[model samples]
Structure formats: C-alpha cells, structure tokens
Target: MSNLFTLSSKLAAQLDQELMGPKVGFTLQQLMELAGFSVAQAVQKEYAIDDLNKNKKVLVIAGPGNNGGDGLVCARHLKLFGYNPVVYYPKRSSRTEFYGQLVKQLDFFNIPILEESDDWLQYLKPEQTICIIDAIFGFSFKSPMREPFGKIVDEVSKIDNTIPVVAVDVPSGWDVDEGPTSETYITPSLLVSLTVPKPCSKHIDTAKTSHYVGGRFIPNHFAEKYGFKTFKYQSTEQVMKL
Candidate 1:
C-alpha cells in the first residue's frame, strides 16, 4: 500500500466501536484473532531478520483491555509456532468476557502467566536473544502515569539489551494523537499498527526502526467509508512496511 491514513485516537475509537458493535458485525473474538494473527506474522518476519535464538523465549507484556487480549492471543499463536511465550498480564477489565476467554486459551496452551509481583530482572539476560511483544496498551489508554503500569514501562526502558521489542499497536505510554511525551517512552524495534496506524506513528523515526501495517480483516467498504488512505497488501502478504 503506497498511501496510508493516520487516525486520531477519537477516530480509531469510533472505528473500533462500530466494528465491535452490531453494525460492523465483527465480534471481540474475531477482531482479537485477526490482530493476533497479524502480530504473529510480524514476529516471524523479525525472527528471520534478527536470527533470534530459537531456544530463547518471547515475553508478552499485556495490559487490561482488548490490547492485552491481543497479546494473549499472540502468545498462543507463538507457542503453536514453536516459540515459548511468557505473558505478563497484570490486570483485566471486568466488563469483557473476551479477556477471560483469552486467559483460558493461554492456560490451555500451558504458557506461563507471570505474576505482577515477580522480579522481571531475573528474566533478563544481556547476551541472550530475547524478543518482547509490548501489547500493554492500545487506543483506549489515557495518561498521567498509573501505579504498576508506570513502573512496568520504567522497567522496560531500563532493559539495556538488543532484545527487540514488537509493539502491537501504539507503544505503551504513548499518546495516540500527541505522540511521546519524552524520549524515555518505549520505542519498539518493530511496530505493527493494526488495521490503520494512529497519529502517534508519525513520531516514529523510520530511519532507526521498522514500522508495519497489518490487520487484514478490515473490509474495503469500511475503509472507503472511513476514508482510510490506501495500501496494496497482496494476497500473499499479511503485512506491509511503512
């Protein structure tokens, strides 16, 4: 796709609302699967490019919303593809049953669910080839810095290693419209913007990082209706670099 649209947080939220509600006819489960699969495709691309250690593990840091659900789903797919993925999901919203379903699926796969109190440093090894999937936040996040999440983002920033991070949508702690508040934000090595990227993606320095647009489930009519700028994701490809 040569042309792409940059969506404000409000517009992104609207699209999600329409799709998840009765009008769009896409359920939380379906959307989660599409997102998870798209992320899996991106991860495979990274693993090949970096020659990451097969024996080394993947860590998925997930938040409390559907963003976290996407991470949970990603972990399951990674495991099925023969990569060990550990989840660090600290919270869950009571309003959505999808979160519970995601948890159950991860449990069925026997993937490890890291407790919030666990020391994350123990999982880090400077020389080891590790990849972190930051699914900690999405379009719904607001900022001023909260408790454990703030601490968690701090921890991620402190990791002084080449362990490439793949952010699912918007990077955690980043503003969808305002971009990053500081350079200390979680700058991922690979960013997979689901369906269409949010406005914050414009802040990403393409010279130093790889950005991609995935999530192939958006219908053409919806794209036209929403005025999404175009891209050409051929049938053989699931993602396109930005």
Candidate 2:
C-alpha cells in the first residue's frame, strides 16, 4: 500500500515534462507506446479474476484524446486476454494524428468501435454482466462537463450498481486535484493511476474500491528529481496496488 507519494494535476504535468519532454527525454511516441501497453497490462489481473463469470463483458467509453488512446490499447488487450470489450468512442474532432493511429490499431485488431449517440447508455445491458472502462477524461479536463461527456458521466453513475466501472487515470468528470465536485461523477470500482497517484485519487474510498499505480515506463531520474521513494510501480511490476 505504500508508494512514492501523490501529486497534484499541475505537479503531474511537471513530472511528465521532466521525463517525456523534448531533448534528453522520452518522446511522446515512445511514451504513448509504453503508456498504452502498460495500462493494458496493469488491469489484466482484474480482467481474469476467477469469480468474474465469462458472461461478463467489457464496455470501454473513450474520449478523443491521449486518454482515449490508452483505452483503445486496453480494449485490444482485453480481447486477447479472453474478454469481449466493445468501445464507445465519438470521434467528432481530430485531437491529433497519434489519435488516429490509436484508432487504426484498434481497428487492426478487429475491435468493435461505436460512435457516440443519444442512447449510448443502451449498450450497458441490465440483464447482462458487464464492467465499464472510463477513458473519457484525464487530468487536463476542466470543470463543467460538456454535452456528451457530461451526460455520459451522469449515465454511468446510474449504472454503478449493475456494472462496476474501472477508470483509466482520473475518474471521468472528477476534479483533477480534490476529486469529484458533485455526486454526478462516475464512481469507479477500480481506479488505475498511471506512473504515480494523483492528488485527487486520495479522495477515493480505498475500503470499497481497488486503487493501483500503473504506467511502469518512467525512468528513475525523474523519481529522484521529485524525491520519490522509487514507488515500485515503474520498477518492480507493470502495476502495483497502492
């Protein structure tokens, strides 16, 4: 349960720049590659739990950003690991070329991708066993959730009892530093914090939900700069519960 420590959204960005910035740092290309794979591997343990019946399926709600890209990567791994994962990604705007590549890779794997619609909530079948993967928003998200995302988060909240949601980094619609500003935030059964735990994650109810540190790609130099305690996430294993 002990680890490097928690960081605010601002400090999280600072840590990213220190290790993944321009010169003398890992390129976004390299970072994204490692990031996607690490995330997939991190949550693999949960996907294969013996108690989870094979009747359960995965529902991935992805946004059009790096976070969504990570979800796309995770979906593929979920499929290869023997779980059926269907993605709901509304690709309205082109966030970046890399984003396209992520989608392309998902398609290459023959994963089913759905576009955002008014009744996207229909995908969560009440009669069927399911788990959600919230990849909608990451740390950069600001307050006042927008149209599709706001409604989507609210919808997901409604289904928490039937299906457990596993948020990728920060929970969708949650404040990056403090936590959810309102009850509308989607409460995840499992929250996987990449690299290090963010400040807002401190608010998560560890007694009820599982919180793990993932993204075992950052180098030790960055950890030393922040005086981190070598966390054992980006080192020992692909993912470690904190």
Candidate 3:
C-alpha cells in the first residue's frame, strides 16, 4: 500500500510549489471554495437528489487552518441552498488569515458559529440524518490531537454509524503524507481530496468512499519554483456518471 500511495519527497515538494506559486493564481481561499462547492455538488449527485443547494442538514467541523476555512465556505453555500448547516469552529489562537476572513464572511451571511456549549448532538440524529462535513485537518498536520479539538473529534465519533461524513482534504487526524496518527481519528464515510488525491487516499483506513475534487491545476512554472508539480483531477465526468 505504501508503494502504491506514497509520494516521494521530490514529488511532494513539487506539489507544494504548484499550490503556493503565482502562476496558478489559485489562492488557498479559491482552492478551498472550489473544493467545497465540488464536494456539495458530488453529494447531491451521489444521492441522486435534486435541490442540493436547498436541502439536507450539514454539520461542519472546522479546525484552525485553511481546511477550516473551506468548511466555513461550505456552510455558507449550504445556507444559500437552504440547508441548515451548522458550523463548529474550535477555539484556537494560532489560526490562519483565511480563517479570519471566513469568519467575517460567515458574519456577513448571518450564519452563527456554534459554541462548544451548544448541544450539537441534539441537532443531529445518527440514523435519520443527511451528512456531516469534516474539515478539521488538512495536509500539513503532524501532531496528535490535543485539548478542545481532540475532545470535539471524540464527541463527533459518538454519532451512530448510519450517518455519512464527507471529509475535506482528509480525515481530521489522518496524515496525508504519512500514515494514521497514534491518537483517535474521525473516519469519514466519504473523503473529498481537493485539487488532487493525496497519498493517504490509498490507505485502507482513510475513508470508505474516497473521491477527488477538481480545480485549476498548479502551473508547471510554479511547480518548478516550488520544486513540485500539481495535478488536478479531471474525473468530473466520471463523478457525474456515478
């Protein structure tokens, strides 16, 4: 499995270059928004349901990075479509600039952030629900879960198996470049990899339904600048066919 999914250091470096370089003109926020929309679109298509923008109950678990910003975007999109999507952002001091901007966007949209004190469990029933969006962690994570975030993951795990989870980028605690963490992790029903599939996608424990999201690829010049290449999934047709 490692041989099949492992990304060499050179390749990983190339990807990072493509992701952060100027040629692509794809900021982290844009990538995140595209990814969130793609995930929502895929969900609607997968369930063979109409009115996706206006249906379903979505619970978004957000962390402190750009991944959390993506979840916030998803929540706003869900609200526009008429779904009651609740966003929970665990308090953290070291948050990304994108996250702060997203918070302001949520405020403009009048979407209230869920407090830890709020009874989130009461709003979601494991057996008779729609979807849970996991955006708690992204590719850069390396440490074990700690404090309130770890506690949040534990609580979310308590949800019955009947509920389906759509994870953004990767599952909260799973490492994209390496293997699973030593601590407890969230197992998403469907894992949505933004831009391209990460090495972790090939892991047997990553997700039952792992799918790649599409966006503009990182340009080669940028990849070269950053010493990595970027690959965007062109399988939207296949996803639509599913």
Query: How does residue 224 of candidate 2 score in lDDT?
Result: 69
What lDDT score belongs to each candidate, Candidate 1 first? 0.79, 0.75, 0.64
Q: By TM-score, rank the candidates, best first.
A: 1, 2, 3
Once fitted onto the true fold, the runs of candidate 3 whose alpha carbons sit more than 4 angstroms away are: 1-14, 22-25, 47-56, 92-97, 205-207, 219-242
Runs of candidate 2 exceeding 4 Å displacement: 1-4, 49-52, 126-129, 233-236
Q: What TM-score, computed on C-alpha atoms, does each candidate reach?
A: 0.91, 0.89, 0.76
CA lDDT for candidate 3:
0.64
* Highest-lDDT candidate: 1
Residue-by-residue lDDT tens digits, candidate 3, 114-212: 867776675457533477888887777776777677777776666625677777767777787664673777777776666555777676453356455
Poorest stretch of ten by lDDT in candidate 1: 120-129
Q: Residue pairs in steric clash, candidate 1?
A: 1-231, 1-232
Each prediction's RMSD over C-alphas, in Å, is 2.4, 2.6, 4.2
lDDT of 2 by residue, 169-223 (tens): 8998788887888558988888988877887787788776788777777568767
* Regions of candidate 1 where Cα sits further than 4 Å from its true position: 1-4, 49-52, 182-184
- lDDT per residue, candidate 1, 1-242, as tens digits? 22447888888888888988886688878988989888988888777524447677788888887888889899998898888788887776567777887888899999988868775555555454368888988877777767678887877877723677888889887887777864456878888999888888887777656888888877687888778754689777778877
